[model samples]
Target: LTVSVVVAAKRENITHHQHANVGDLSSAHGFHTTTSTSYYVTFLVESGDRIELCVSGTEYGMLVEGDTGRLTFQGTRYLSFERI
Candidate 1:
């Protein structure tokens, strides 16, 4: 519980960061991506597990194959998300 709270509090405005391929981004042609810093409380994650985006502050249900994701940035974009 404490770990979860810490992680949740750690989030701030997302930084438009790197271009790592969203490994499980879906394989269909009509995939739509959402944005939000909040991840589902139920989803268990590990290193290298593809973290799905939820721009609407919800949870990731599932992902399709072939879908791709990349964080974008411009000169004036947020930098805190600088992916450590």
Candidate 2:
């Protein structure tokens, strides 16, 4: 599916997790950290409706706010955006 829309906004969400291990007196202690990131884009359609969709890092990088384009998708999945 495709729709004509204007790029409204973009956002990124990141989450971090930390793990710690404690050993006996003969051993050592250590800490490990992990992070996860997600990207999303918001579009304004001709009907004046705004829709937010989760996108990949590459897709997010290619989109710019206030850009007008054609958004191609399958259901809630994001495919690509072609600037008009």
Candidate 3:
């Protein structure tokens, strides 16, 4: 199954930000430089866009192949992992 979400206007505040670990990486490059802490990106869906995704869509793919959840955007862009 497919899910479609509609976002409302003037609700951009609903968008949010998040971070993730990016593993170890050298930055200094000065003799014995220490590893630096890196962060990845995450999403905070808010409004203005439509999101059509399956509920079973995550990292491990779809569980039942037809389960979906629609998260209507109000003022931000809709972003998420695909189901299949």
**Local accuracy by lDDT, each model:** 0.28, 0.89, 0.30
Tens-digit lDDT track of model 1 for 33-77: 545354321112233333322322321222223323333323323
What is the overall TM-score of model 3 with all chains considered together?
Answer: 0.19
Ranking by TM-score: 2, 3, 1
Point out where model 2 deviates above 4 Å: 21-28
Candidates in order, TM-scores: namely 0.16, 0.83, 0.19
Q: Give candidate 3's total backbone clashes.
A: 11
Report clash pairs, candidate 2. none
Residue lDDT tens for model 3, 18-79: 33324425433323323433222222233433333322224223223233334333333333
